[model samples]
Target: MKNLANNVGVSTIGIATFFLTVVVVVLIEHFTTFNIFTLSFFIVFPAGALICGAAAASGYYFGALWLHRRPTILIFVQILLVAAIAQFAIYYGEYRLLDLGDGRMASDVVSFKDYLDVYLSSTHLRVGRGALDTGAVGNFGRVLAFTQFLGFIVGGIFVFVMLRVYPVCEQCARYLRILAKKTQLFSKQEDFTRFYDTVFEVPVDGPDFVTLMKWQQEKDEKAVRGTIQSETTLRGCPHCKTQRISQEIKVWGEKEFRDVPQLTRHLRIPDGIDLTSAFKTV
Candidate 1:
């Protein structure tokens, strides 16, 4: 998890951007009859949900980029908080725009309970439903809250999956740079020989007598080191100061060939064997 207090700057900027988006959406709804959903509930609710999701995704991206960590649970909670605040702002904006009675707006004097009653009544009218009691209105509010929360989750997951599947270096969390590509071939050789040698000798008499025997033996066996032939790519990560070598070994008994120009081939080593040592004669 991230230290929320330490990220106050980013959080503050994110909150401010969300509210700004909400205000623009509210103004558009107020001046024009633009309902996000054909069913009532005002355009503000869906607009707020979208803004909240976007804000949450941005938060997660920035957290990963700057802090090298994305705290999924914390970001989700932050999204919910942003959505709730946006909903309240939308309600308050609409309340001020509405004339309650005697040329007075609900923003001037209406209590929270009275606001809910008015808001729910308008919702019912827009949805073509009959009057709803306080209990029904409360239930509808919970359902709306739940749907908005789901929107935030969907947005967060979308961005998270994109980041994971993207071609990036695991260690540095940055894009990888291809350093080199080459193919190699490996070979081995063995040699064996049979020979005879004196096996033992015995003394028959202390002064002059001696005997000798011979035996057959195998010796001077030699084996060439196994060589690996492969096509390999060398990649480096600039951010984490690391390198990765990826190789695809050629199948055994395959003939090796160089596709590059002769000059280029001369400059590069063959895939599997080291030319300097392989060419040396013993």
Candidate 2:
């Protein structure tokens, strides 16, 4: 029942956000003479469309955080629906608001379908400082439609990716609060391995664990070839008081630090475990 109510609330907020985004997008395009849905400055890259999509997807992102929504297939479908509706709303809103000279509104004279056809036929691509001639109206309209659709789909996928990466407290039905983030650097591979073993192999309340917790904070810098970097993130559920720690290992590459996927680990901290001393700098 609680989840249902939360879902309803999120849905309402999302709807409101969708309308707001549509209005803003329409106004922006009207005043600026820039069509975000079909904008592409770089060759084959729909930068403006993606930005518009991100704007449209913000509602779903915040709504999820409001109730700690776990992204499911249903949520994914809802996001896509929101994307489709939002795009339609923007197009229609723009059509209605358009002034077709001599105090005439586009919507007052023509139906939405007719207006859409005219709009697409009249649309031209802007290249640099001049307009680029799109040979045929039909081909240009098709390309525009394809770019807009692809951008929204990619935006929906990004929302899901973000939600999945964030840690959530399933028991409390809330997003986990990040407690602290600490990093440890090692000059030798064997030293890092020992450090890894100490943290993962030893029990939370063990002597080695306490020793590690008391270690002084280290300054973060670019890793050298022989150096190993371990980044630890601590998060907790406020309601249930459950804590989780995740560690990611990185090895120095020719230009940057590359992640060691196999070295990543996530561990649950027992309740009542005092972590204050470990995060002195936090």
lDDT of 1 by residue, 86-109 (tens): 555665666667665598877678
lDDT of each: 0.45, 0.74
Candidate 2 lDDT tens digits, 113-159:
98888776676665666666655565577567667777766776677
How do the predictions measure up, each by TM-score?
0.43, 0.78
Error of 2 at 170 (Å): 5.7
* lDDT, residue 179, candidate 1: 62
Locate the minimum summed-lDDT window of 10 residues in model 2: 213-222
Q: In candidate 1, how many Å is residue 97 off?
A: 4.0
